[model samples]
Target: MVPKRKNSLGGGGAIPASAIVLGGGEGRRMGGNKLFLAVDGLLLLHCVLDRICPWFREVLLAVGPKDASSLSLLLEGRSWASPVRVVVDRAPGKGPLAGLVAGLREMDSPWAFLMGCDMPWIQEPLVRRMWALREREEGVLCWEREGYLEPLHAFYSRSCLPFAEEALARKDHKLKSFYPQVPVQVVPEEAFADLPGHRRSFEGINTPLQLERFRESR
Candidate 1:
């Protein structure tokens, strides 16, 4: 495990870093809350939390209003490395942007790593590399694949709250809508070439077929 770094701002504080997992999707394609779907004897949401919790001071799960009850039940007896908090989306059905906003508001960290619950194959080394790359920057740091921005799997600074909120206010829930208003560093594919499974690191299981394939592969 990488040693936790102290916050560089001085004052004898630990690094104010946290992670947010967005599990509030309607799951229209999956026919149900995909996060609860089992994989390797554990729920998909638990798998994601277990992988990312160790890397941050706090990890928050943003779920839809209806999904909260079941999720709380699933977490009852589970143990996690970092403190885990469950946050209900303030604006349900507003898409990932709303979930992001909800998670950011609850986070005490100045920066947070954002991801979808369906993306169970997140690479820790790649995540750590992105953390290192954002050390001196004050914006979102994420990877770009085949001309598409992976906003859900990225690093966001709390400083971007205004832009995010503004986009939400305008009902423009697209995650990228607020990107133009903030400083963004798009990590290219080659940047993660040396990391194993880089190609699948950003993959998400959004449908039953994908989940079935993932299960079979595992």
Candidate 2:
């Protein structure tokens, strides 16, 4: 039971920000929709949602058209996520960046922590810690020395919507395509060395092998 959209959200514990969850992936690597896949009896999507719902006032889930109706049914009315909304990707198959564009437009917060449904290992405390680094940057992202960036596990401000739109218009769907236009704080991996399982925090379970390995590691 999806909650009705409210003009106001209940207060007390949730952070003022929102968590934007991107679950529009085709999941070809996982053989099908991976959101339904489970780890320890909990659906992967549920795992990710449960972890962040307590930390944010609202959460926006971006999904392709196919999952729209089903997801509405899946919510089962989690009151903690009272103001949650399921935003369908305007460009259905254009990938995560498309999902991102849709989310940004509907978001009600200045800061939205972006993440993927497949990435259930995200750590909220570490992410909250990164909030300070977002001082003047348009967003904050995790970057590796190997030239890899974990955009799915970063934070983006409402201000980035236009730049993201500009990139989408040019068919440049990569998240970094709009990077040069915005100031993004690129935090190095070393900064996360102190958090236990920090490396796994950005690990996405997009493939069966990765899921298997993750389960084995636990």
Candidate 3:
């Protein structure tokens, strides 16, 4: 969905960067395209974009080639603060790694916030703080409890594209497999607790039960 852009933005000015939302996931665990599930009154993807567009200069939806035609006209009114464009995966059936590679290749901005479309509760303060650290490394993400890293909730520079493509070429699609090839700044999970929604920013609704749980919790 390409929402209408605002005439002028006013909140401390949006960060000079772009956002790449990974909408290309197969979503087999959810039965179908979970991004189409209703959230409040809007489609899940719209809810995610509405909040995100206000904080970035441009927004890109990295979707699967099969979904390309349907998603091309998902939005038709003034619902976002920035312009949005859709880029299809060059290699369909590949995971988020392929989507990220396609997004980075199409991205014109030096830095971009990359995430999954299932995330509609991303907090602005968390995003702003992360944007401030854009130049600190080739990639920046939050490290969760235990040994897990929240790769989806991160900022990636265009410089990481080559390494990502390298991984994709070798068929090592694990999102973090390419991390070792690039410089990364790991934001401690404690610092994440300082935000409004805390770790909610990293949580994604990947299944029907998880979506139901989120709806019931609200």
Could you give the C-alpha RMSD of every candidate to the true structure, in order shown?
A: 5.1, 7.8, 6.7
Alpha carbon deviation, residue 170, candidate 2 (Å): 0.9
Cα lDDT of model 2 overall? Answer: 0.75
* Clash count of each predicted structure: 0, 0, 0
lDDT by residue for model 2 (7-49), tens: 1222246666778888887789898877678777767777677
**Compared with the true structure, what per-residue lDDT tens digits does model 1 show for residues 120-173?**
888777777666555345789787777788998898989888899999999999
Q: Predicted candidate 1: what Cα RMSD to the true structure?
A: 5.1
Better of 1 and 3 by lDDT: 1
The worst-scoring run of ten residues by lDDT in candidate 1 lies at 1-10
Candidate with more favorable, higher TM-score: 1 or 2 = 1
Question: TM-score for every candidate vs. truth?
Answer: 0.88, 0.84, 0.86
Which parts of model 2 are misplaced by more than 4 Å?
1-13, 137-147, 212-218
For model 1, the superposed segments whose C-alpha errors exceed 4 Å read: 1-16
Measured by TM-score, the strongest candidate is 1
TM-score for predicted model 2 compared with the true structure: 0.84
Candidate 3 residue lDDT tens string, 1-218? 11121221213567777899988766788878765777566687887887789788898888887888788877665467888888999987788888888888998788888888888777777676655533364554444544677788777888889999999999999888799888887655554454556667778898888887767765
